[model samples]
Target: MIEIFGIPLSAFLSQLLLGLVNGSFYAMLSLGLAVIFGMLNIINFAHGALYMMGAFLAWMGLEYLGLNYWAMLLLAPLAVGVLGILIERLMLRWLYKLDHLYGLLLTFGITLVAEGVFRSFYGVSGQRYAVPDLLTGATDLGFMVLPNYRAWVVVASITVCLAVWALIEKTTLGATLRAGTENPRLVQAFGINVPRMVTLTYAGGVALAAFAGVLAAPILQVQPLMGSNLIIVVFAVVVIGGMGSILGSILTGLGLGVIEGLTKVFYPEASNTVVFLIMDIVLLIRPAGLFGKER
Candidate 1:
């Protein structure tokens, strides 16, 4: 068997694939954060809770409503998105003019509340979500066997990320959103409802988080604290990529995941801290982040 860097090639490939799967989650989660921060200037600390909500919603739907994975894939996000709309209309709208710290605090409180509410009902134990029938098997990829569900995750995440990127960076509506956030008065003068647009933008970002949650439910155990477990690392990814940079978040997230996976292979002890170590180095070197422009 061929080996790379003293590790068996098959093992390396398997780890690499695992890394990419992790990267897909990172990309999706960070993309949502980037959209919210970049466009709304709000530090959404409740994102993880919302993600947890998404997964739980999916699980609940499956359990009670007889909804399948495919159905929850669309419904869960929509449900979360509507909740996001309420959050924006009821609470977040009032804080837009204040400091980013306020938004962070408010969202943090929301996160606590959300997690508490779920924990009260569900406790800390994780719930299982079975993989869909169509994606239940594994594929032989010459050397390494790839799980269909994991491959779907990577493809789905990339597709969503790219679609969002294009929507924000290329389309006319994206231009309007950018313009609205940058100069709301100017957009408002053109007969656009800036407030509504902003609300929708926030909702969209929240929906993205929910979408990621649905994707993760089958792979990871669903639980109230699951979001909290991953949110800190995800925040590190966002910081390293740049607070509000779309492309930066996507690339940094994926890169960090792969780096973490590789670290697990070579130096298992440092696997957990590798991303943060890189984050520290990045902050020292380019405080603005890799794809972020210094503001």
Candidate 2:
């Protein structure tokens, strides 16, 4: 058996794969945060709550309506996105002209209320979500047995990340969004509906979080607190990657996951803290973040 650094190569590969899977989740969630902050300047403390709602929506749909994972993939986001739109129009929009802290406080309160309601109904126990039949097995890669579901997760995450990046970086609509972020009044002066754009952007960002939750359902159990557990790490990823850069979020998230995984193998005690350590180092060096432009 070939060994790398005195550890079996297969063991190392498995860990790397696990890290990549985790990074996928981080990338998607952080990307959503970046988009919302970039466009609306809202801290969105309720994002984790929205993510939890997505998973519950999926679970409920499955349990009550016989909706499969594939259908929930579309339905969950749409449902969550609509809810986000409602929040934006009815609640978040009024805060745009005020201090950013107000937005954060409101969202935090929203998080508390949402989490309390769900915990009351579901308790802390996780609900099971089986892998779809189409992706239920494992494949031998000579060195590692790669689970099909995990592979699907990695591929789906990467695709979504890339698609979002392109939408925000390449398209004409994306240009308008960026311009609005820089100066909404000017964009509105040019006849663009800035308020509408802001509302849609928030909805889109929320939908992205919901989409990630749906993706995570099979791998992680559906629970009220699942999103809360991961949201802080994801926020760290956003800060490390730079809050508004799409590509930065993607790369930083994946890189941190790989680093975290490597830490588990080489220094088990530091695995959980490695990402935060890197974030601290990055902040010390570039306060604006790895990809953010200094204001």
Candidate 3:
């Protein structure tokens, strides 16, 4: 067997592919967190719960409404966005008048209730969602067989991340968003509706998370506990990338995913803990994160 770095090349590549998929999810979720935190100064703990809701919504669409994967991709995130708007209007809206800690507590409580409601009904046995017909096969690349669904996930996620990065980093609206977060009162004085913008920003971040959830449904089991399981890991990625840099979040996510994947190939027992270990080391050495500015 041909090997690279004392490991079979096939094994190494396979783990790398798996890591890329995992990184896609991490990047999307952390992007949401970064956007919300940067703009609202709110640590939205409900993000993962909302992500679970998105997957469940896609599943329900297929099971009861005869909706296809494409439809779910378009509608699930919108549904999640609408729900996020409601949360902003009802709960988060009030916290803007108070300390940022209150916003964190409010969202954390929402996470608990959201996860609990789903658990009461789903009971966490895991719900299976089939990949769309178009993505159900495997492709042979001579050296290895790649699952179409996984490939699609990696491509789609990277595309979305780049689009988001371009939007915020290159476009005027992105500039305004960043500026508004820094000084909402000034932006408002300049004729921007900062409050509404703030709401939309949160909704946008939530939509990204929901979109990732829908993408994940067919590959991972749709279960109430899924979001909770992923939340801490994504948080670790956010910490390592810095909560303020969008590009940093995306890069760290994909890079960490590959590193974690390689760890699995070389040392399966340490794969799960590798990300956290990196996080601790990063914190000790660079507390502001890999791409974060020191405060």
Candidate 4:
């Protein structure tokens, strides 16, 4: 066996691949949260629930409607995004005028309702999702056999993250979006519909989360409680990255996921609390987060 630092090279690289897979999902979900928080100033507690909804929606499409994976990829997120717009218009809009805590509470309630409803149907067990035939199997990398799907996951997520960052940071529409975030009244004075912009920003974020769910379906089980298990850790990622910086969110999420993976390999017990531990340390050293700007 090829060895590095007295450890089999294959073992180390495999763990790295697993870490990158996890990091992909973290980056996608955290980016969505950061976008919503930065623009709407709402800490969405329902994000996890939205992720669950994505899986359920895909299952619904497959079991009854006969939609394929590619189609569901587009349809699921669109459906979820539209629901987000409705939530914004009907419920979240009313709370935006009040304290941020109110928004959090309302979204938290939404999360519970969504999760509970899914649990009633799906039960506690996870349903199996088949990997597309194209993404199946593994490749020999001389030192290790790597799953094609995992590599696909990493590539897809990085592409999505970069595309979204470009849309938000480089485009004209992005300029408008950012301006609306900082000064809605001013943006509105110039005839841009600020409220509608806010609604769309939130919808975009929700869609991003749902899309991540679709990606996760093949590797992780498609279960009602899936998001509930991981959402808290994602929130920590958001805090550690600075809420407004899209790149910060992506880097912080991937970094933490790798750290967690390594902890599991070396010290199994600490894996559970590793992210939280880092969160506390970051809070102590820089309350603004690793890439956050001081307010």
Candidate 1 RMSD computed on C-alpha atoms after optimal superposition onto the true structure:
0.7
Candidate 4 residue lDDT tens string, 1-295: 7876666888878887888888888999999999999888899999999988887788778889988778888999999999999999999988776898999999999999988888898898998888888889999999899999899989998899999999998999999999998888899999999999999999999999999988888888898889999899999999999877788999998998898887777777998899999999999999999999999
Off by over 4 Å in 1: none
Each model's lDDT comes to 0.94, 0.91, 0.92, 0.90
Ranking by lDDT: 1, 3, 2, 4
- Model 2 TM-score (2 dp): 0.97
| Residue pairs in collision within model 1 | none
lDDT of 1 by residue, 41-127 (tens): 999999999999999999999999999999999999999999999999999999989999999999999999999999999999999
lDDT of 1: 0.94
Of models 1 and 4, which has the larger TM-score? Answer: 1
lDDT tens digits by residue: candidate 2, 118-200: 99998999999988999999999999899999999899999999999999999999999999988888999999998889889
- Among all windows of 10 consecutive residues in model 3, the one with the lowest summed lDDT is 93-102
Better of 3 and 4 by lDDT: 3
Better-scoring candidate (lDDT), 2 or 4: 2
- Give the residue spans of candidate 3 off by over 4 A: none
Best by TM-score: 1
The residue pairs that clash in candidate 3, if any, are: none
